[model samples]
Target: MLEPILVAARGRIIAGVLGGAAGVVVIVLLVLALTPRAGGGTVLVPDETPAPRWAPPADPPVAAVTPGPYGIAGLAEPAWVARTAKATGIPRRALAAYAGAAMTKASAMPACGLSWTTLAGIGRVESDHGRHGGSTIGADGTATPPIFGPALDGDGVARIPDSDQGAIDGDTKADRAVGPMQLIPQTWRNWHTDANADGREDPQNIDDAVMASANYLCRASTGLDTEAGWRRAITSYNDATTYIDAVARAAEGYRTAADR
Candidate 1:
């Protein structure tokens, strides 16, 4: 009887010990399964997946065009014209009038290569475009006589005769500094060619003036496109340094504007 009771007690104690050991094994397994894995060379663990990558769009390209010869002047704005006139120190209205006159005359005679800007500059220097009125006397008792004769022709047109005698001594005071371009009687004689279909040489006529100016420039210019040639041509138009500078500046402005 004593031996049987002892055996039963031993069996109960062994079973309890086995059950406790199984529970501990389950707890350890749960902890390991729930824990997160870290990134490493040998870890072989899953990490936050990287966001899907995408490419950016590109911008469109700009196209450029080549311009024609003397295109700059064609693009000349009013502001540019005004600015150029201001830079030249010439009156705005006077410059415009002169430019317009030259343009009209040259266009009428397309063969004339004289640029309107060059002619305008010349007009400014010569007779101040007939504004000076051939010189005048001051308020004082001094007679400021005419440096040259009249600017109007017989028909009130600007006229300069081709004859040497006429140049030296013309009957009409109006024959003095012919047209807006101011061609003198003698100078006009040298440069005159019947550009227009007119029967005789007429320097005072705007048509004649424009053609003469063009011819003179071409003759004086060794190379029309060159800076040096421009300088020589402008200087020949009037021997004054001021006149040359003014014309050169105006020409440069014209070329730049036309090119644009």
Candidate 2:
């Protein structure tokens, strides 16, 4: 009987040990199910899209002004002149002269579409609005220190002998292009006008130069409104393909910048 009792006690101890082992296995499985896997676990991600980059607002279009005189007693400048000058990096006085010349031309010759930007283009190409070579445009529209082109003595340039006799170009031997617009003495004499209404036709004066340019451009067969007209007018100014291209590029730049 004692042997049987010992055997029964051994069986009960073995069963208790097996039950504890089974309980540990179940607890391990529960822990594994509650815990997250390395990369297979579900995560709460916010569904949102990123904002786009910002851009500056577009500028409003400038209104056109009625045609009028561009002299000292000329019409007042529209508010857009200042704004366009600031936008295009051009000086206010130069911009005003260009705009004033265009308006004056419009009044004098209504058929011509002489925009201020075109004049500005020519000014930039010619003498940088009279600021070329350390020179500046004075308050009276005169280029300070004066501006003169190389003497046209047939030395790889047009061979035009002195026409003014040292009166205008100050060169008694050969004629040199004078002023910011680079006008030959004869050409200045032919198309000269008192743009400033100061009773004198001065080539060094911005107003005089601008008015002369407008007159010459308008005299072209086409009126500067169409592409052909524009090209023809610009050619009339310099008569060179390179010059026309440069003026066109500058004018387009000014126009596009003003719109911005």
Off by over 4 Å in 1: 1-114, 127-163, 167-177, 252-260
- After superposition on all CA atoms, how large is the RMSD of candidate 2? 38.1
TM-score of each: 0.40, 0.71
Q: Estimate every model's Cα lDDT from 0 to 1.
A: 0.37, 0.59
Per-residue lDDT tens digits for candidate 1, residues 1-260, read 00001111111111111132222110000000111224310111222533112111111111113311111221223454476556654444344333443343344543333455565545443433323333322221111233333433433332434345455335434334444354555546556655343455555434345456565555554443345555655545544343344445444444454344
Prediction 2 TM-score vs. true: 0.71
- Measured by lDDT, the strongest candidate is 2
Task: Quote the positional error of residue 220 for candidate 1 in Å.
Answer: 1.8
User: Candidate 2 lDDT (Cα, whole model)?
Assistant: 0.59
> Where does candidate 2 stray beyond 4 Å?
1-78
